[model samples]
Target: MSEKVTVLVAGSWGTALASVLADNGLQVTVWARSEEQVAEMNQQHTNTKYLPDAVLSTQITATSDLAAAMDGTKAVVIVAPSKAMRQVCSDLKPYYHPDMLCIHATKGFETKTLKRMSTVISEELGCLESDVVVLSGPSHAEEVVKRLPTTVVVASHNAKAAAAAQSLFMNEDYFRVYTNLDLVGVELAGALKNIIALGAGMVDGLGFGDNAKAALLTRGLAEMVRVGSEMGANPLTFSGLAGIGDLMVTASSQHSRNWRAGYMLGQGKSLDEVMASMNMVVEGIRTTEAARDISLKYNVQMPIAEQLYHVLFEQSDPRTAVETLMGRNPKNEMEVMKLETWQQWHS
Candidate 1:
């Protein structure tokens, strides 16, 4: 028998995951933030506003009331935007059970504290490290909802919690789940990739070819690993599905809001203009700040992340940032390998 799970997803990704779980025979209750979204899910059995074409199964219930939606849930998957996670979880905490295996699918750090999604979940829900989990990978909601083959990683300090989440989402058909014990590495990898995805999008928008994109992604991976290591994450996690896998998807896929935002910037659109046109919150905008702060805090050198930060926040000219990056003194790629080795040997 399939275990029933309750999911809290206020956006398209959450809706998409709920759809996948329901399709796999797990009963799910999704908390829709808006009355309109709730109505569409409950009455129409479809999220017309966000997921217009896909039909949500009747087994998944959508509700506006927080307590009502969370009642009797076996486990919880929180999929709201990172910026909104604190408030949402705070509101739900009165009803959140300590025994619940709380899993987060949202990627991006909390700007004020620079806390990763799992950390935020830990704070808001008052849960111990063992109770928190994160699931991430190179997944796009538009693709995942369509039953496209997608693989994701589930990470937790406690293997039991990770296994619980692994069992909930794994299947032979459209979705697959891999497990990891590095929660910090997984969450940092998930958050940091958005910044690189922005960089990749800029390259594409500037009409740079595959060669340029390949270079950007490669360096981007190095930068992500560098900063993540500084933050005490396992460097090997960067080579896994949560790291390289997510970087590839967010950087190249059209379904990525961060990639699209960076592409618009590359095309010379002002940040305000690009933001005005986007219906969903592009996490890259906030992540750029967190990554920049993390670099300074850890004394890590992340030229690409820093440059993209300037482009996004400081209003640095995209063309100029690109020029500056290319003009930097040429160095051997061995620096990256050396740093990785040092991290492993030192710690």
Candidate 2:
């Protein structure tokens, strides 16, 4: 019998990850609230609404019953959106038990509490925060579902749990997984990049050239490093896959919902219009909101994020936001970050 692994929720990312686990010879059980959706996946082996283009593996199954889904599972992959994470984990609390490796693939933080996904999972499940592994990187579900070459990082303070996740998801042919010990950096980088992606999209929407987008990404990364460093993360983590790599893909890719939403906003659509048009959850929108709170709390200067927040919430014009960013006081580009965490590495 194949080892059982449960994936909570049936969104695009969750369903895509389910395919990966099934490909690894695990019995992938997905828990979704919709019974009709569950029946379709179990009977037809496809998730038409989320992943209409790809056919899911036969080894994968779906259920509406949480207890049945979690039963006898060796690992649980939490892929719910940031908004629903706390409640989803709370619902799973009854089924959570020791020795079942808990890994969360959600990228954004809880908007109300500002807690990381892993922390939210641990609190709800009553496990040590370190026990929950964070799975993140440049990989997008649209590409990963098609078995395209994708790399992701599984991070945790628990080396053993991280290695278990890497072993469970790593596929030499298409899916590659690496383990990291820096949990904060991994999670923060994954979440913070979305804010920049929103900015990138707005820049594109405003007809800003490649030079503008490239500069946004580079400076956005600097902001990420600065805040992440202040929050006790290794500043170098932003230089790794979960940082620059993910930022590059999310900010520039046509498949990114955040980028698409920002593009519409830049083209002069309101947030309401963009939200209505986007049938899917744009994680970047919520992440942008959370980033604003984080920047204020950390006392960090995140000009792009602040401007994007204003454009997104305060109804500031996208073009005006761009102009504001461009008109900021000049600084030494190389010495601007003032990052002390990474500086200690050289000394």
Candidate 3:
């Protein structure tokens, strides 16, 4: 079986996955937008801007040419930021063949149309949306590069495609992959968690103790489930690796850009200032907006995401947002779980 895979964009996550593929003894090619970045990765075997401390595998090469990178590749893993998914997919379309298995690891919604990354990719590639696999979980780039023990899920409506993605990157020593049939759940859980992560970071930045952070994560998961369920995602998927697992990591880890951005916001930094300081994409900011819009469209209540949306866009005070959250009318914790009727779980 051929193990040649092409990963789009040389961001931290993309680079880490490429390294994983290389460690699996597969030939990997990373497509970078910048000629300088491609040259650096090919010749130096290091992506200093993204993964400065980690050295890349010799089997991993890079190219700026999309056509050259896609050539002879059996699988294509796209890790571009959600904002640029459409253009990147458009660029890949000319070189894309139907035989190639398409997977995306990007986590967020397209701002304009508010579509998921898989949807954007499928639209551009002219393939069935369910055929595009989504790879998402708690794994972080910095740790994955160091060969840490990490498990993630690959989901697709097509079982064979999901299994193929599972086999492509699963490594017993460090990386592990699971196959999930709930494509919508996996993708929604992965994207919506970033909003909660931002809230978690804000809690930390405000110097709140573990209690506050824990509360945010708990309620945030509720918000995620509320909107995700309304969007045709399985509620049980929220308990899986792509749901609570991803949420826990993103909301707590220093490697999470969304968390860091939220932290800055909590520390009295303006959205503009915080964004200017960060070199990488902060997915939560955009995800917050998308979630807010989604909640409105689906008639779901996502208080955390809604507040974050106000803070990020309307310049609402972070302290005020926190107080507003705390002052909301008290309700049953299981209120969100009610399906059409108010029957209790133990009923």
- Whose TM-score is greatest here? 2
Assess candidate 3 and give its TM-score to the true structure.
0.97
Residue 284 CA displacement from its true place in model 1, Å:
1.0
lDDT to native, each model: 0.87, 0.91, 0.91
lDDT (10s digit) by residue, model 3, range 150-230: 999999999999999999999999999999999998999999999999989998999987998999999989888878777
State each model's C-alpha RMSD to the native: 1.7, 1.1, 2.1
List the candidate 1 regions with Cα displacement exceeding 4 Å: 337-347
lDDT of predicted model 2 = 0.91
Cα lDDT of candidate 1 equals 0.87
Give the count of colliding residue pairs in each prediction.
Answer: 0, 0, 0
How does each model score on TM-score?
0.96, 0.98, 0.97
Q: What is the lDDT of residue 337 in candidate 2?
A: 51
Residues forming the 10-long window of minimal summed lDDT in candidate 2: 334-343
lDDT of 3: 0.91
RMSD of candidate 1 to true structure, Å: 1.7
The per-residue C-alpha lDDT of model 3 at residue 260 equals 94
